[model samples]
Target: MRRIVNITILLYVLFGVSMYIYFFTGSDIGIPVEYKGTSADPTTFMNARELVLSEEYSSVKNFLFFLGTPFEWIVLFLFMVLGVSSKFEQWAKAITSKRFVQFFIYFFYFSISMFLLIFPFRFVSYQLSKAYHISVQSFSSWMKDMTIDFWVNFIMMFVAMHVLLLLMKKSKRRWWIYAWCMTVPLTLFLTFVQPVLLDPLYHEFRPLQNKQLEERILEMAEKADIPANHVYEVNMSEKTTALNAYVTGIGSNSRIVLWDTTLEKLGENEVLFIMAHEMAHYVKKHIYWGIGLGLGVSLVGFFVVYKLVSFIQRRFGKMMRVEGKGSFAVIPLLLLLFSLFSFVISPFTNYVSRYEERQADTYAIEMTKDNESAVKAFQTLAKTGLNEVDPPMLVKIFRHTHPAIVERILFLESYDGKIDR
Candidate 1:
């Protein structure tokens, strides 16, 4: 029975590694190119922009994205089957009989596994950035950044996991109630505090120092009916050359973060357009909508896991390998299964996100009254991010968070007249 468990673990690890290698190596992934002159074919240029901005490559990336769902399902199915077996039940009974021992074993294993997986990826990703000449920081600097990030996230995860365990013990319907209660608060905290508290751990943040630009942004915010205090800038140039920006938080705490790299690369008009787009998200209340959608999806995922686990236990209770009864070692296995189920729903989530992004883009056009800057900003962003010029369609559906750049440009071009503020 122990050997069988070991075999299962080995197989799972191998499968994961295989998938990673296949996706990382098989895709013709490369950094975005600098945009050249009018001599470039318009259709080709647009396609290239779309590919870069969308981060799509050949069909390989899309295939891997799609493949994630089934792979997760397989893992979940195996866990469900193994968890309910007589042998696993016995093991669970023993572990639950000593709660401290059970907790320590699972917690330690989880922590170690997460660290091993995440830390190396951080190092490798940094190396890749350096190789591409996109990195702005040295290895030592990157390591310092990683250390700060690790501690912040590690502490948060520790607190959250313990809280979840507490909730799991108290709830009558463990998965559903836990999911519902945790989702709202977790989403809110991550959206709000993450930018203000967590982000500063990795990069320095300062107020927008360009008084003229700042004033213009505030004016735009007032015109757009978004609060002025939410606009700020972060010194992201110390970390990487990749241009980026985001809107986060909610209500009074909500704010816009403009990467210094973006501010440096884009003209004032382009920056204003980007700021307008972010403000649109806040004014339109997309943050709250997104959180609500996330909660709903999480609830559905929890229910699916609960039902599936129950079914497995009922169907094959005697065959399970574990010794004892009513063990909760099965919980992690259930989580693994749920993760797989959630991956299946990722496309829907991406679609919803893309829709919200499009709305924000429209708002930017209206506010800026200049589709040209918006187009230029996207092109510049693509170049900064080393985006592929044209990714396959399947890649777009599975992986893209925003509409392809070409699609966005075409949409803007379709406007019949000057956009009204």
Candidate 2:
């Protein structure tokens, strides 16, 4: 019976992954490369406002792009229903009945199972990236980074689940509220330490090497009243060809970081525009506001979960071998619920993000007073990143965090601000 169950689980995983790739990833279909506007603004961007990719290229990218959190939720559900988590708990009990030791053992067994189950998706995604020349790193180097990422995520999951499960064991009804409360401080702590501690484990970082450019960026930061001590540069070129920049951490820990690739590939004007966008996030207090909004939504989510989880536990716990929220066996069920909640709330979350992203774009345009620079920077980013210039409304509402590239460029071109320096 046990062997049959194991085989069933294996088949389910194999079949599910294949179907997921086929339906959600995308098929081999031709994609048209057409720009909407006929008139080219030579002052704005060289290519007018358009995104062009080969039919094969689009398929490969879309193929690798697993649809959001559903895949994750499905994998978690399978892991639970197959009694994988329970089996791990049983194995750990043979080693030692100690709750502390069991949690650690359970963490590895469950985490490794989840990781391995998702490994094919990761492997295929990386393979496609390399095939497309977007990822430059060798296979061995990629695996090392993946290992580091796994451990970092392991620690985070352990901390969060440990607190929640402990609370669950103590009080049935109030644990969700307490867990939500705990996340406020925990989330901030992780955010504060991420740039300082965790990020270095995966990539090397240094202060910007070009003193002239660094000084100019600092000047803009001063104008924006952004209190960054040093503009940092990360060695992202070692891994991928993608361009990215962001502000991370908070208060004493806050810093604006640019990818080394940005320096290598972009002109100095474009770099300043990018810096202005990141600085706007800090100057506008988007980071803190984001945290506040997250906590507020979390409070609501936890309340909903509090009502629903017990009902689930009461109805299906014994049959599924997931006794309650406190049981390790319940992890998969909880993940299913969390994934559903996240997916339902995603549109609202993305709406907020898109709004903030537009604000940053506007701020960059106003601060730099160089619409040309902002537009060109985004063009470069879209070219490198293969961003959709004008996504449909559904994509924007459900997934995209930023305004479409064409929309941003058009907004910049039409804005009434001029910088006088």
lDDT of 2: 0.76
TM-score per prediction, in order, is 0.76, 0.87
Question: lDDT scores for all predictions?
Answer: 0.66, 0.76
Candidate 2 deviant stretches above 4 angstroms: 1-35, 38-60, 66-68, 392-394, 418-421
| Tens digits of lDDT, candidate 1, 1-421 | 5676677667766876765655555554432343233212133444655544345333333444454444444444454455532334355346676764555455545444445544544565566666565677887887787667666765665565555555545663674566567677778878878766777777677778888899899998888777666467888787688787888777666778898889899999999889988988888889889888988888888788767756655665445422123354454455566677766787899999999998898888877888778778877765666554344445566678888765676566555455452
Worst 10 residues of 1 by lDDT: 34-43
What would the per-residue lDDT of candidate 2 be over residues 1-421, giving only the tens digit for each residue? 4664577567666765764565345432211234334212222333433333423344455434434244676567666666787898888777887887888888789889888878888888888778767789999999998899899889888878777789889998799889998989988998899898988998899999999999999999888777766899999998987799998898799979999988887899999989999998998899998999889988989888777778877886666678744677776776678768877898999889888998888888888888777777877776676555555444556668887776677677667764221
Q: List candidate 1 segments past 4 Å from native.
A: 1-105, 118-122, 163-175, 313-328, 417-421
Q: For all the candidates, what are their Cα RMSDs to the real structure?
A: 5.8, 4.6
Number of backbone-clashing residue pairs for each candidate, in the order shown: 27, 0
